[model samples]
Target: MTDSALAPIDALLRTHIAEYPGFPTPGVLFRDITPLLRDAAALRTVIQHWKTLIPEGIEYIVGTEARGFVLGAPLAYEIGAGFIPVRKAGKLPGNPAGLSYDLEYGSARIEIPENSLPAGARTLVVDDLLATGGTAAATLELVRRFDVEVLGATFLIELAGLAGRDQLPGVPLTAVWTIQD
Candidate 1:
């Protein structure tokens, strides 16, 4: 789709994003995107927007496990890039590279297959949201173990006030929306 076609998509996201206060904890407001995902047109717009940012030589898209899968799979197909999952520890079979980090509520580890991509392969990381940057940062570290060149990290939304970008120094980031908390 053309750039002009994406305007409606941006508008749809602003209209549909639902906000919940004290979600999963007190003093925390969550920008719920399920409403936007439920709208077919909005979802298509987001995928198309993401497709435009994928670098030309990207061989793989490393998507964080779970929610990231929702965006990454369709995006992989859209751009003809291979999809690799950065899963929680023990969720993957065979040997994988693991990295540990803390989340808003707890600490955890994420992993990816050691040989998922060839050495020096270019990759793009995708996820639904960027909050504290822990998950994305850990995933980036895991990808580096394979000696791959990370193209960038992309997200549907970024919580600007959380300072997630600070954790991701030197890496490019792209997001459709930015919300200051």
Candidate 2:
């Protein structure tokens, strides 16, 4: 959608997102979308915007562990695609494809369950938020293990100026809201 067309949704999202100062740690501000998730109209609006960004023939939506599941599952259902979770280390049931990456404070790992997406399946990576992109990048790598074609990545919100998009490199990225940090 055009920038002007998205203004109302953008404004709606800005109001729905609650801010918490020094959350999870000191010196960090957190953007919370729980309010948006609770409001059906707001949630539907977000899904609609994201749906428009999706390419045809997306076989699956691979969501990051936790919040991604919240967003991706519905998008997958709406788009008639399967949903796969990129889990944190040891969160999967079987021997899943895994990738280790470095976070701001330490190292971390994410996994995609074995036999999740068939080879050559077209997939989209999705998440609630994109900050530093360490987790998102690792999730992308883990999804690639299935040998599927990644159509693109999408986020409900992107914390701009952190260069999270840099980690994604050549992938097409669409964010419902890009918040300057």
Who wins the lDDT comparison? 2
Q: List runs of model 2 lying over 4 Å from the truth.
A: none
Clashes of each: 0, 0
Cα lDDT, all candidates: 0.85, 0.88
Model 1 residue 92 CA deviation in Å: 1.2
Query: Each candidate: RMSD to true structure?
Result: 2.5, 1.3
Question: What local lDDT does model 2 show for residue 71?
Answer: 92
As a whole number from 0 to 100, the lDDT of residue 152 in candidate 1 is 93
**Over 4 Å off, model 1:** 1-7
The alpha-carbon lDDT assigned to residue 139 of candidate 2 equals 88
Question: Mind giving the per-residue lDDT tens digits that candidate 1 earns over 15-86?
Answer: 988889999789778778788779888788788877886577778998998879888888888998999988
**TM-score of each model, in listed order:** 0.90, 0.94
